[model samples]
Target: MAFSSDLDQITRAASGDRQAVSALVNRYSPGVLALATRMLADRAEAEDVTQEAFIRAWKALPTWEPRAKFSTWLHRVALNLCYDRLRKRRDSTMAELPERVDMALRPDDALDQSERVQAVEGAIAALPERQAAALTLCALQDHSQAEAAAIMEISVEALESLLARARRTLRTVLMERSEA
Candidate 1:
């Protein structure tokens, strides 16, 4: 009956149906890409991580359980890939600069905005992996705390603690940036 239920699509994907795989990719790729980009802070790396995440999902589909939502499983996979890359990288300067704005802007204003953005990004990059992941999922992605906690494989209370710590760290970092 599992194959006849809400997971019929995933059942097909598990059995190596290209159409099911394609459908799943289309439905979830954007979210995976966003999570990877936000977590890694590197669009190119994020794209690679996204691709790898889907490939892994495809491989693991045979063993996939229906308990967790597919999206949550995929996010966890993507976060793990992002963390792997984060671990292997050594140089602090390796983090990508803030994305360039396409809008035409005054010279001084652009400079100011760019600096502020970079400072914020740098602060985020400096956070502990778990805390940063918690904040990224809950705050930026608009995921419910319950959902984010599930994705991070932590209790909701722990997620709240991480969020508080990450916020305090971000505040201190930004304030220091402004003062300097």
Candidate 2:
């Protein structure tokens, strides 16, 4: 969607325009769902997080500034919701490490490729929160460093550092997994 159209829709939505709100939801839900699904690794929980993110966006629409892309700000909202869920899981009495999913691919595809992908995803989920967020925004979602930094509420330098550490950690974790 074009920026002008987005700006107009957001502006209208903030003023209680139902159609504008629906348009915005349709435009952004997939991205939000992708982010949440990647972060949470559970489709049901990710769907809940995505819905909560949209509800939060509706509440915050009136105060939203158009200085940044609506998608960027929406990502911030979605990610924050992911963080909230992750935090709750961490604090739970029965909290345990995230489980691995056995990826089933086509019969013609290589099993090694599926194993590598699963290992990488498991490594990502094992990362420290900030490192995971940095990698998710910069590597997975293709957000520029500057845009990611703004969404993460960190300096560009800090974001880059997090990315570097995340990459290093992922490599180490994956290597260990392979050796085991």
Candidate 3:
């Protein structure tokens, strides 16, 4: 059967179709990994989150209602898993600090572009969790404000506020780093 009929596959999986469940995982795994990587900021941790998300999605499949898009539901699940991991690591002791050095921006070459991207990613990673989440959902993921709000379980106005704050914070952080 074509997996494009995702709703049917979901129904079959709900009725205990193991292959259908596998198809669901196969279909959504890449998107889950991308989202996890952006949120977790560590490749290994993102991998773990992606695996855990699929496991949770499979286990929760029976109870999943068809109210929202399946991808949207999966995104929410992955995001929540990332949040849980962040909470668990909140109080961990830090290793010795590395000396801060102002790195020059060299965006001409591909390597320099990659480094610049990584620096920007690091800045985003340092943002407050809610701000990062909001930016990820609305800006990076290209979701509309209303859709992002629905995924975040907040009102559209609240989502817009979060997006505004995230953008302002990112601009300030980037500008400060550039001036350094």
Candidate 4:
């Protein structure tokens, strides 16, 4: 199958095929950057995390077992790096704030789409890390409940519980902001 060929490329990269590794980087870097940006909310920090994640992935490739999809593995790496940066910031008393998406350019946009996006992102950023991770992995990243649960190392039922709470909290936050 076509999927197996992609997996072969990853395996080849793991075996020190530089071209294969570079190709993998080219293929997955954008997605990684997007995911990091969504999770971290700071473009510069997200870029840094994205770079570090690739470096880490390259270093760890030889040890990688092809048990899961390569993209899934890469996502886990990116998520771990984001959490590490957040933890470091927390320890240093320098928690970075989420960036507000600009909405001034298109005031007539349907349903105030820009404002809603900013509000949702802000609410997600304010969530507890686990809840945010769950929402990001499931809702934003389009991972199935099983896949998200697998990535989070939680049981399916536990993931469902987390998803429920995350959605409820997000709704409350958005509604409260709308009422303000």
Q: Which residue pairs overlap in candidate 3's backbone?
A: none
lDDT tens digits, residues 126-164, model 4?
A: 777778888888888767887777777788898888889
lDDT of 3 by residue, 117-179 (tens): 677667666677777788888778766777677777789888888879988887777667667
- In terms of lDDT, the poorest run of 10 residues in model 4 is 100-109
Give the alpha carbon lDDT tens digit for every residue of 130-164 in model 1.
Answer: 88898889887867887799888999999999999
Candidate 2 local lDDT, residue 112: 82
User: Which of candidates 2 and 3 reaches a greater TM-score?
Assistant: 2
lDDT of 3 at 49: 87
Scored by TM-score, the top model is 2
- What TM-score, computed on C-alpha atoms, does each candidate reach? 0.77, 0.82, 0.80, 0.81
lDDT of 4: 0.77
lDDT of 1: 0.78
Cα lDDT tens digits, model 2, 1-180, are 577898999999999999998999888898788778777777899899898888888887898788888888888988899899889988885556566544433335466875756656666877887898899888988678888898888999999899999999877765565455
Model 1 ranges off by over 4 Å: 1-6, 15-19, 91-118
Residue 105 in model 3: shift from native, Å? Answer: 6.1
Lowest summed lDDT across 10 adjacent residues in model 2 is found at 100-109
- Candidate 4: residue pairs that collide: none
TM-score: the better of candidates 1 and 4? 4
